[model samples]
Target chain A: GDQVEQSPSALSLHEGTGSALRCNFTTTMRAVQWFQQNSRGSLINLFYLASGTKENGRLKSTFNSKESYSTLHIRDAQLEDSGTYFCAAGSNTGYQNFYFGKGTSLTVIP
Target chain B: AQTIHQWPVAEIKAVGSPLSLGCTIKGKSSPNLYWYWQATGGTLQQLFYSITVGQVESVVQLNLSASRPKDDQFILSTEKLLLSHSGFYLCAWSHGLGGATGQLYFGEGSKLTVL
Candidate 1:
């Protein structure tokens, strides 16, 4: 079974619009990280959260360990924000295997 | 600031040819190193990890092996390439145990095309 399940496999938004992407975990996850992958296949780290929420510019993310889920909210989207978004979750004990979501493809149109 | 560099950028090789990809992390010490692979349009899969010199652990065996000969350098190699090995290879480093509290940083990545 997949440890993480990401939602809204694809999305499109007009410039300046807002939307959110989510991931649900099948097991207990102690931490979660959000990433944006550009067309060149480079992954840029967006957020890393053990608990609570983090806000960075037009992006905000929240990780709920108890509920086993995480979300990334994009506000005032821009053309440069077009890319694939992924969330990875990991546990605290043992070998520390981080499970990654399939990713959400976001396209911001002008 | 710490930076991760992956070499060769991209490569095209024959099916039976040997392959080696290198990653070097500058400005950080004793970092936990990891290797991840992603097929086209697929999710990232962890392949190997190393906590210290000369000790590498395999996460998923895709006919690949990794080594940590130096504190800042990690290498992924195979005796012979397989068409299935064609994908984006990423090298990452994290402080501490790379668990709940550790944040991971990734390199620019290396792309392989095995024919």
Candidate 2:
């Protein structure tokens, strides 16, 4: 079984619309990180959360360790937000190893 | 401030050929170095990690080996390249603490094409 299962493998939103991406963890993860990979193959860190939630600009992320899930919400989407988003989780066993989801491809159009 | 650099932005090699990829992290001393690989349209998988100079650990076995020659340098190589090895290779660094407690910074990545 996959350690991390991400939902909505692909999404589309209008310029001003909003959407959320979720990752369900099979194990009890200690922390999770969200990333946005641009067209040039560069990964931009969006958020790192151990518990509770975090917000930065138009992006907000929440990590629920007990429930074994995490969600990244994108609000007021912009053209720049069009990219592939990924969530990587670290379990309680070893922090050195992080498992990544298949990723959600997001496209924001006018 | 810290910056990670991966060498040979991209390369196209033939099967059975030898290959080497390098990563260097600057401005951060004794940072944890990691190697991640992603196949075309696939998930990213951790390959190797090094916490100190001359110490390397493999997280996945894809017929590849990694070495940490210097405190800030990590190198991935193989004696023979396989078609399955073609993908995007990324180098990342994090604070000495575990990723479970801190953030991980990544480099632009290197693209490999095995023909």
Candidate 3:
């Protein structure tokens, strides 16, 4: 069983529209990190959340440790935002090994 | 202020050839290091990790092995490459805080192609 699970394995959004991605953890997680992998294959860190919500530009993320889930929201999507989004959860294990979701491939069309 | 360097960027090699990838960390000391592999269009998979010099732990075996010969260097190598070994290799390091909240920073990554 995968420790981290992401919803809507793929998504499409029209420019100026919005959508949200979610990750559910099977066990308690110490933190969650969201990343965007561009077409060029570079993984860019978006948000690293230990708890609560964080908003940057048109992107926002929330991590609920009690619920063992996290969500990323994108408002007014842009063409450059098209990429694969992954949410990884770090467990309490001493090594802090991260378990990543399969990823949500998002495409924004103008 | 820390930076990770991974090279050679990309490589192409024939099957059965030996392969080696390197990663170096700067501006940090005794950092926890990790190796992750992602197959074409696949999710990231943990391969190996090291907490200190001369101590490496294997998370998944894919005909690949890792070594932390020096405090700031981690190496991933193979005696003979397998076609299944082709993928994007990522080198990451963390501050080694007691909890998992510590963030892990990644290098530029190396892409391998096995012909």
Candidate 4:
């Protein structure tokens, strides 16, 4: 069975502060995607990386296949960034099935 | 631009009752559809996925079944629901192929509360 573990289960940040959330895989993954679930339970896909790194706005993500791990870095955190962040690892096994990490709850306060 | 829609924002049902949830994708042709469940204090668990009409694959069977009646429509149903079925259900779609195929666009989830 494939497993994805996320660290820093919860985080609190002041506006403009920064931090990183990580996901480690039990098996090699072909790619990974990060998502933020809002209060309305809508998921916003932030990043999808097959390898290396990708950046969008104040968020940056990196995936190291050889290391079987991925990281999401948030810079200049804002109150709007408060939500539950999850990382889903896509397995190359077949049909691109994904294993999700227990989300990291982030709250950026004023 | 593409959009995904899920029906019935929330529901409350008694145990042993039947249940059905639906999802539809618009502005995308034959997209890969998926159903995911999230329990309280738990992670997202993929339940089913469909690549085309009339075909669906179950990932984790929590005593529920799914069907793809049309190219853009997916239905999840159970003849008898249990308390364990209470959770948040989400509908998602992806490009279905290519390197970044994992990138998913999700719809507002449907919450189920079985009493």
Worst 10 residues of 1 chain A by lDDT: A90-99
Residue-level lDDT of model 4, residues B1-115, one tens digit each, is: 8888899899999999999999988998878889999997688999999888999999997999999999889999999999999999998888765523657778898999999
TM-score of chain B of 4: 0.95
What is the fnat of model 2 with respect to the true interface contacts? Answer: 0.56
Q: Model 4: which residue pairs collide?
A: none
Flag regions of model 1 displaced more than 4 Å: A93-95, B98-100
Q: How close to the true structure is residue A107 of candidate 4, measured as C-alpha lDDT?
A: 93
**lDDT by residue (tens digit), candidate 2, A22-91:** 9999988888999999987889999988899999988999999999999999999999999999999987
What's the number of clashes in each of the models?
Answer: 0, 0, 0, 0
Name model 4 segments beyond 4 Å from true: B98-100
DockQ score, prediction 2:
0.58
Angstrom error at residue A95, model 4: 2.8
Q: What share of the true interface contacts does each candidate keep?
A: 0.44, 0.56, 0.23, 0.58
Runs in model 2 deviating more than 4 A are A92-95, B98-100
Per-residue lDDT tens digits for candidate 3, residues A29-73, read: 988999999775678999999899999999999999999999999
TM (chain A), candidate 3: 0.96
TM-score for each prediction? 0.97, 0.96, 0.96, 0.94
Please write out the lDDT profile of model 3 over residues B55-114, one tens digit for every residue.
Answer: 999999798999999989999999899999999999998876564446878888999999
lDDT of each: 0.93, 0.91, 0.92, 0.90
| Candidate 3 chain B: 10-residue stretch with minimal lDDT | B95-104
True contacts kept of 1: 0.44
